[model samples]
Target chain A: MFEAYLTLMVFGVVSVGFAVASLIGAWLLRPRVPDPIKATTYECGVEAVGSTEIKTNFRFYVVALLFVIFDVEALFVIPWAVSAKTMDIGFVVGEMMVFLAVLFAGLMYAWKKGALVWD
Target chain B: MSETNRENVKNSGEDSQGSAQAPVPGVAKPSIPAAAHAKPAAAAARPAAKPAAPAEVLPEPRLNNGRGRLLGSARLWPTEVWPNPWARPSFVRGAYWLAGIVAGVLLLGWSVGEISVWANLAYDWAMNLLRLRQVPELWAQGAWSAVKVVVVFHLVALAPLFLVWWERKISAHMQSRLGPMYVGGFHGWAQTIADGIKLMLKEDVSPRAADAWIHLLAPIVAAAPAVLAFAPVYFGSGLTAADIDIGVLYIFAVSGMTVIGIVMAGWGSGNKFSLLGGLRAGAQLVSYELPRTFSVIPVILLVGSLNLTAINDFQSGYWLGFIPRWFIFYPVMGQIAFVIFLIASVAETNRIPFDIPEAESELVAGFHTEYSGMKFSLFFFAEYAYVFLSSALVATFFLGGGNAPLPFLRIWPSWLWFFAKTGLIAFCFLWFRWTFPRFRVDRLMDFNWKFLLPWSFANIAFGAVYLFL
Candidate 1:
């Protein structure tokens, strides 16, 4: 029963190993010619002219906030979706509808507050 | 010539600094002071200048259909179609008809026998000849698992090589040109192979300002999940790497990790374009994930299992003796789910028109702007691997996975059917890349939250109604 998960672990290890091995192989075969000019950050041939850590737009934060709220809600609903077929249709559907309606109301609230808008 | 190039670079650098200090039309006022922009090593030699004021309102993208509210129904903006000689040549038309006829005849011929039965017999014979029947079950299982790991790893690694070539050829043909016609002969079938070799031999460069540890790890983060996500996928009737019960959930959770890799690539590079691309990807992938997950609720409800094999089995039979009972065939509800899922999947893979994260004209190569050589190729490998993964899931969730559409078509092995459906859907991904223009960043987000999210939620309600009916 647990062996499938072990297989998954093996797959994970092998996959990461493939990446690391490829890098190692490339390091072995590739030539290293270091130049100060080559090490500079690319700004489409112009000299890069500022710190890379500029202030980001505030709208991305709002989107992230909205995503967390809905993603958690979806996660809660998945188990119900899986088990609903065996349960009473009316009871399950009614229960899920109320849950979804409340979340839908939350989504609407976010919409009205302009949290969903990107500049 | 060298002096002229240096003079050009110096002039452009000064010009860019000058523009940075000037109030550009339509750009929102920068919160940072003008002096902050000149903090770089080369730029510090220049004297500080006063900041510019907001000159003009940035022209709002015409994407919102001119409605005052940003939350209107997303519309397909007009596209400029160019006349292309190669688009529909006489030979191409004949080739399509000829291909269709050949497929029809093949399907007809295929109906006479089943290949899986023969495969099973051959497998048993091989095992008997090797005297492996007496082996312990655990050892056998371990060996089989090892074989599966190798096969899946190779599949993840090699699919991209073929897909990249296929996409290039497809896009080239769509634009009235031949792509890679010379490398390794036969319309450059081995073009990707040659490119792979070239990439491996190329020098890996890291920007002087880059976070060396994170830069090195980014490709692994981006790629490993793509390969691991394949563990739960069902390739055929009994072919799977792990066969986990929560297969659907597992794939979603693992593939979500790829975004982190992308963000790492963006941030670790220490380039503004890479950072912006990463941030955009982070937001865009997160936004679309909502709709993608919600769209699959109907199928999960119907199948009552997150296990992919069970879901595939649920869609195996026909309704009314002819029409297949695949989830996509369900009235109204399935179509909505399928369309939403397809759209969201495209966005998830970061292809055009949703490819704002790496919008080449705007963001350079996006988060990967600083990556080079084998490290760069890893990102490409992960991307094309994702393209294959999403298409496979689309086939599994909407189309009947490993199930023949007609009773007569059941003679072909289920794995063949599975791959055939996956390939057809993969072609659509390539087709979409060449067909549509990139979306504006704002409208791209709006399409998800306002449009796709609402529809996907409404779709679940529709699925409930369809359930008892």
Candidate 2:
């Protein structure tokens, strides 16, 4: 298991090195020709208007919140799914059904609260 | 500027002279009057911009010919460009085509046979030659690990080049056009190489208002996770770079980091389109990821291990002497889970129908819009690499990674089988890109939440009951 992780670590270092190397290669090969017009933010030829960091729809925030809830739910689900195969089938089924039922109820609540509905 | 002025004068003189005559017999009149009027107004506004007209009256019939038709259609095609000779077959071309096919088959056969085994032996011999007497075991192990890392890197780097080229060819053929016909010897094999060189040579642009550090780091972040995700993927029996116990979990957790890079690109660019693209990517990837993760649960339950090799091993035996026990073949629930996994994979990779984040018509290239040169190519590389990784996972989980269909036919190497299965899955991805239209943002969210999410949940429930039975 530790060896497996070591492989991942080596791959990570190598990948970062490769990315940096490619970037450096591009920097060396590319021409540096900067102009005010060229460096300006592209907005389909029109001059950009207003700030980009405006308030977005609350719907996106709601999605983020839902994702957090469900992601945590998944964190619980995987181990159960794996170990459940070796446990008593009836008991495992009953327990998972209960867990899923509560999760389903939460989804329903969010749906009713208009959190899932994108305006 | 002076050249454009002269061209404008030439265009206006031709347009006015052409419009003064009777309308063409069958052609539809040009739709926009503003375009017709603007040309003459420019001519009137700047008298010096106009060229002196020769007394010679060129035949007005030139406007009604093929050139006129091309202009009227509002499409750009240079009439002077020579038609590709490959479109027509000569004896030499046919012979070359036949030779290429034969060579490809021979190469495939060689790779599936002694070539790979010999390559491994050669590497081991080289390592043995370099081994120190003091710590031979440690030295050998370190060298082997280095070799493994190099192989993984090669897979991560080179696979995308082939996949990108294959995607272009596949998508082009699907749409009835020739893709990359001229670059390399046969069917533009070196097109991606040329593109890579061009990308490196082009000016690397960053917006003046953009955050320089985050903008530069975003591509690295985006690309690194894709490379890391390959760690747990098994290429063949005993051929994994890292055979971790929590292989599935590791892959999902790492691939999830790609969203951070996209979000950083969006936020760092200081462009509303980039931010919107990034937010949409985050939301879409997050939403679809649930179903993608859940879809794998059924496979895990059936296989009884989180290790990818274990899952692959579980699918190896025949069910009834003829049918292979692939997870996808497990009655009803397995099929449901596979279908859900495939759809979610499509959305996760931001392909057609779920490509809202970078919808060219809407977002103007999305999160990486401000990026150019190598920075832009990094995102392109990461996307194709993800496609490969996703297809490899699909093959491993569902289609039986590196497992032959028939027990009697086991001559080919296991890695070849794995790649063949992956190629088929990757082809399906390309096919879907060419076949489907982009989904609307609301509709995309609805399909995931309303349709795929519920189905994935149901698939898990069905798997539980099926396993119990």
Candidate 1 per-residue C-alpha lDDT over B200-257 given as tens digits, one digit per residue, 9 for 90 to 100: 9999999998999999999999988989999989887877778899999999999999
Scored by Cα lDDT, where does model 2 land?
0.83
Q: Identify the leading candidate in terms of DockQ.
A: 2
- Per-residue lDDT of model 2, residues B54-114, tens digit only: 2332343334464432244332232223367555444468679879976786468546663
The candidate that wins on lDDT is 1
> How well does candidate 2 score on lDDT at residue B143?
62
Summing lDDT over every window of 10 consecutive residues in candidate 1 chain B, give the lowest-scoring window. Answer: B71-80
Among incorrect, acceptable, medium and high, the docking class of model 2 is: medium
DockQ of 2: 0.65
lDDT of 2 at B469: 70
Q: Score the docking of each candidate (DockQ).
A: 0.55, 0.65
Worst 10 residues of 2 chain B by lDDT: B73-82
Model 1 bad stretches (over 4 Å)? B1-139
